[model samples]
Target: MTLNAETMARFAQVYRDNRGAVYAYLYGRAPEHDLAEDLTSETFVRALRAFDAYVAGDRPIRAWLFTIARNLVTDEMKSARRRRQTPLPDMLDESRFVVAEPDPAELVSAGHARDSIRSSLARLGGDQARCLVLRFFEERSIGETSTVMRRSPGAIKALQHRGIDSLRALITTGAIAP
Candidate 1:
């Protein structure tokens, strides 16, 4: 794949448009912000290198990029386990603390609602969580998600329905902290 001006321009456009969403998705899964940012950069770099070979077909570019992102996160999780590393909640970093910034606790509380959803989805396990993430966060349609997940549309629908039910139960039962 030639790194021509036109090609580079298109990739740049994609990066500008989707970087935030990609980072948000990664930040939710990756244990740390730095790791999330790094994974986000790697995602785009991988996407660019593979861009020439990428065929959109019925799936949008976002879904393809997310597939790459998901795989990277999975690899990172496995590597973490191999290293026997566990993520501690946000560590005390006095230097990075800024007065103007909202309190970390407050910010976390603000996201409590979102966190519960993610926590519950995670509790639902791998296939269901992946289906929900691709369907909801990446805004992929059922057909697109099926293509990305390599599942039948009917399977995707079943998974989605079951995931939603489990998530509702988790939240309603106070299984995940609000």
Candidate 2:
């Protein structure tokens, strides 16, 4: 399909609006924040190039962008497995010492909660983690998640249930704190 100025502008607007949510979703899964940001940029670039193929839907642009990002993450995971790369947890821990601007007290508390969720997510299998991210962090509806995940609503529900269960177990085990 031919690229046009209007289409490009719309894609840019959509990317700007959804980029933070996409980054959060990626950061939830990626071992390193830099890698997550890199993948998020790549995802938007890919989405811009593929904008003509995007369909308008009841779900927001973030859901569509997430589907694409999820696919990329899956491919990366497959490649990592084939290459026998270092485990995700080890990689995550290696990057945990980065410095960021100081947060306020409430922000620090919220950050702690997010860190707990991230730690629990890291323990989940890829599909489960993706499902949870889409459902919770992305705040997508069940139907939207089913579309992004390419699963039946029932299946997505089951995964959501099991994923939450796993997360709760982690919280109880102190792998993550509430």
Candidate 3:
């Protein structure tokens, strides 16, 4: 499908508005920054290629973008699993796999509260977690979140409520300190 000037402009606007949220979502799910960056880039590239097929009124653009990102991550995981094989002794390099310690300054930069919140978020169920991320972290309105999540607004509200309740319980239990 050919993308006209108007469609290209709209696609650009959508990318600009949702890029950070997409990257954050990818980072949250992926184990490393470089992997997340690669996935995020692939997400946008696929989105651009499929732009002609997207129906604007069916769902919010942000939701469509996220669906693409989610699919890409799933594909990457599958590909990794398929490529996995037993390592031979000669190919092993213990010295090359050093784990880096977290920087003290970076830890200080991310306040305790933010860390706690992230911990709690990680424990939430998939739907609830997505709702919370879209509604709170990304600052999307309920209507917008519902569109992206492909849920009714009422369902989104319920998920948000349950997610918040779970977060509170976690914090109260010191699983995630306030």
Scored by TM-score, the top model is 3
**Candidates in descending TM-score order:** 3, 1, 2
lDDT of 1 by residue, 35-55 (tens): 999999999989999998899
Query: Any idea what lDDT model 3 has?
Result: 0.82
Which of the two, 2 or 3, has more lDDT? Answer: 3
What order do you get sorting by lDDT, best first?
1, 3, 2
The pairs that clash in candidate 2 are none
**Candidate 1, residue 178: CA error in Å?**
21
Worst 10 residues of 2 by lDDT: 85-94
Candidate 2, residues 1-178, lDDT tens digits: the string is 5788898788778877888888877877776678888889989988887789777778666767888888887787777678965555544564668767566988778777778878778876587888987887776779988988899999999988888888888866855322
Candidate 1 lDDT (Cα, 0 to 1):
0.83
| Cα lDDT tens digits for candidate 3, 1-178 | 5888998998899889888888988876676678999998999999999888888896668778889999998988888888965756776676889878899888766656666778778876588778988887666889888877889999999889888887888866845322
Instruction: Write the number of the candidate with greater TM-score, choosing between 2 and 3.
Output: 3
Between candidates 1 and 3, the one scoring higher on lDDT is 1
* Local accuracy by lDDT, each model: 0.83, 0.79, 0.82
Alpha carbon deviation, residue 171, candidate 3 (Å): 4.5
